[model samples]
Structures are given as C-alpha cells and as structure tokens.
Target: MQKKVPQIVFDSKKPENSGIEILTIESLASRKTEIIDHNPEKAHQVAFHMIVFYTQGESKQLVDFVWHPVKKNTIIHLSKGQINAFQFTKKLKGYILLFTETYLKNQINNSPKNEYLRLFNTHLFSPSIQVPQDSNIIRYFDLFYEEYNNHTEDLNQQNTYKSIYSIIFSKLEGLKQFQPFHLKQSKQVNIFLDFKALLELHFKASRNADFYAEKLNITYKHLNTVCKATVSITAKQFIDQFIVLEAKRLLINSDIKSTELAYSLGFEESTNFVKYFKKHTGFTPNNFKKNYL
Candidate 1:
C-alpha cells in the first residue's frame, strides 16, 4: 500500500487570529512537541500557503524534495499542497505567515492586472524573492505583524490588514523582474495557467500536449508557443516535467514501489515508465528514493 505524505492543515493558530497566523521562525521551531506523529525536520505537505522572510542568519528550506539555500532578506512562498520541511537548528531569524485560501481570496486583488499577487505559482515565477535594503517590503511586513498581533478586531483594522498584504505582494511581484526569468504577458500567462489546470486534472489520462491543447480549445502550435513564452519550455516538455515532479513527490513521500507508482501515474507498462523516468531524471525511481530518504 502507498502511504501518503503527511498533509498538515491550517489548524496551527493563536486565539486572537482568525484565518491568518504570524510568528517568528524561532517561536515556530520551539513548538515541535505540539505536533503529534510528525517531525518538522522531515518532508510533509501543507494545506495552507506560507511566507517566510529571512531577516537575518541563513538556512536551507525544502520544498517538493528540493532544498533551497536562503540568506538574509530572502522570502520564500509555499502554496497549498506543496511539500516542505525546515532546518530548525540553523539559527535562522525570520517571520512566517500562514494563511488559508479563503483568507487569501479575501485579501487578493483579483483584478486581471495583478500578476505579482500570483506569488505562490512556482511554475510561473520562483518561490523565493530577494529583498533590497532600501525596499519597504520588510517595513510593511512589520506593520502587518504589529497590526495582526494587536489582538484588536474591527472593520477598520481588517481593511488595514488587507491593504498591507496587498502592498507586500505587489512589491514582491515587482521585484520578480530581478529574477533570471522575466515576466510574461498576461495573456500568455493565463493560457499556460489554463493548460496547467487541465493537465493536473487529466495528466493521469494523457501526457500528450495535444490532448490538453484540444481540451483548452487551442491549436497544438499555439499551446506550444504559449508554454515557451511563459515558462521557456515547449508544451510537451512542461507536461513531462509535471509528471516527473509528481513521481518524485510520491517516491520520496510515500512507501509505494516503483512499479506501483508507474501504473498509478498512467504508464501502460511499468518498464516504459522506468525508462521514461531515467531519461528525464538522471536517477531511476529507486535511486532517487535512496538519496532523498
């Protein structure tokens, strides 16, 4: 049987908070005893979005089995359903903000122009952002901390919370241009996101880009163009990466065997899946498991 990656809920909370919780990383690490049947040092998936801004020191954070080296002013965003783990002993100084999707929907500006608010879409942009000393990102974060922790509830303060979060995300999104990949046009990004949604729903049924393109009601060439423009990869390459990513996620988090996972992921024969996995990733499923585990 395949055991699942432990799925943590948005239950970690404080009495004063409603849908959001903000605390220092040091304080978060000290509550290891509060978690039952799970270790914070090991990989597990979360049901809520997370933001960790490193104000000082250095540490490595694990997301989807990949370890990211982080330093001062580095902020990482982890979305719902992504796997992550922390290095509690690394003397990192930061604040972690955890919020549910409902809270985010209320806070986010859904106006079509605000792509930077798409902070958790690791596919379009990198999950981590480096803040400059002169930037107000940290200042706004501090303001939010003070406001949220004030233990006061009123329509006015609630509106202030929304406004502060909006500024923080927009500022962070504006900083994404500093990353290696520049932002794509909104139309291109929207197309890729649509295709991604369909892929996630039907990836087990088909790995071919044509299947998704047809479902998206666009030409295969158009889909390829959209993917290349948005993520710098062909549509087919994107699908393959998604599959391999899912495979790696399962291999490390669950006790499922290689053949079992292959079938579960929709390979006609287990042997073909083995070859496909090795072709894209250097390691066979078992070898990848051994190293990560």
Candidate 2:
C-alpha cells in the first residue's frame, strides 16, 4: 500500500481542460492514468470536485468507501478530499465533470445564503442523486455538453462555463431536496455546518464535542441539538463518526501502523485508541484493516 491515498490534482494549465474538464467516460478511461498516478480503479482522494452524469449504461462508484449503484441519469458527486474508486466497463456511458476549487468558489461566491453549504454537504447526503428522465437537468447537460464540445477556448477565458456550472448546481440543489434526510435551510443546519467546519480543521487536535462547541461559540447542548437535528446523532457521536470515517480511510489507503495511527489522531495511548475504535466500529484498527483492506 502507499504511504497515503493518492491525491489527484486538477491541471488548469491545459487549455483543453482549463479549470474544468468535460469529457465522456470513454475519454476519461483513456486519460485516467495521466490524472491519477495510482490505479484509477482503486480508491483515491481527489483534490478537486467531480461529478459524473451517466447518460446511458450502469455501474457502481465507490464514494468515501460506499459503493453506490448508478444508472442512466444518475449523478455521482465526489467532493474534494473524498475517496472514490471507479468500476469501469466498456458499456458504460457518461460525462465526467471536473472543476478546480478556485472555479467552484468563484461561482458559488454569489450564491444565496447556505447555498454553497448545501451544494457539497456529502457528510449529510448520499454521494449519488438520481435525475428523473423528464427533468430539465437533462436539457441543461445537453446544452452544456453541446456547447463545451464545440468550443476550443480556455474555459477560464469564458463566462459561459461559470454560468453553466451555477445552472447545473442550482438544478441539482433542487433535486437534492428530494433525497431522504436532506436538511432544509435552517438555523440548525447552519450551526451543524459550522460545527462540521471546526471538526474538520481540529479533528486531529481534539475530538471532544465541547471543544468544537466552544470553538463555534455555541453551548455543548446546542451543538448536540444541531447535530441530532441535522444528522440524527449527538455532537459527540458525530465527532466519533468523523474520526472513525477518517480512520477507515487511512486504514484502507495506507500502511500506517496501529500505534502510529493512534498518536497521529491525538490518542495518547494506543490501547485506548484500539478500545475506542472497537467501541464505535466494532472492530479494532488492525482488525478493520485486515478485514476491509
């Protein structure tokens, strides 16, 4: 195994790709090795956001360690820092939309309040969205695909790319509301998002719910309330779940030892870390790695 999951970066300097890479799944298969140094069929972390819209055929995409079955009109979202693996087949057909973080931020800068948060909240929603065949999203994708293919200009030099991105995003935002357990725009959602931001930044420093609650300037009970409201779990459980998810990612993506992994995750004692891992996931770190990896 590698030291860590391979990080695939966007090549904006390529005029053909620019800040955005729009290509068919067939085209992606040909360029897979150029984008990822490791096996594209294996789980790898992406540095940019990716969306794959299947126009035909069927396949399963592993997103953040979950295998989601996808078919025609299915939109698979792979957010930044998320681990995704592809199961390629000659019969599958799709458009893989990839964009740089800078481009994404620029487009979302003008979005209404909490719109940006709702766009990529993979922590709350599943990574896949099924678009009904009759939906206008198909029309939007067709237009974008048609325009993108005929234009040889750098997308960074054109405003059409940005506008199309926002359009597709807004359309997907509407479809996302239909997903089970999808959170609506609310104060609790905002609180949960803020708490999640802090948790990501300081997860290694401390997994204590109170630490994040204090950082977010919200009481522990309030933080717990928001977490339960948003994710059906208490704040502490959410922190544990986050740690376990990270631990699982590291366990599968790397060959780091149990003791080393424990300290790296802020655990002072390896034994305690082992116990904690088993308590939350029902498997010790080594057992999880052995069973899953």
lDDT of 1 by residue, 1-293 (tens): 22546777888556545577778887778887787867777788888999899988888899877798889899889988788898876577888888888888766645344553466787888787887778778888889889887865575876786777778778877778777777745888888888998988998999999999999899999999999888899999999999999998888777898889999999989899999999999889988778666
Per-model TM-score, in order, reads 0.86, 0.88
Top candidate, metric TM-score: 2
Q: Top model by lDDT, which number?
A: 1
**Model 1 residue 213 CA deviation in Å:** 2.4
Candidate 2 backbone collisions, by pair = none
TM-score of 2: 0.88
Error of 2 at 38 (Å): 2.9
lDDT of each: 0.82, 0.81
Clash pairs for candidate 1: none
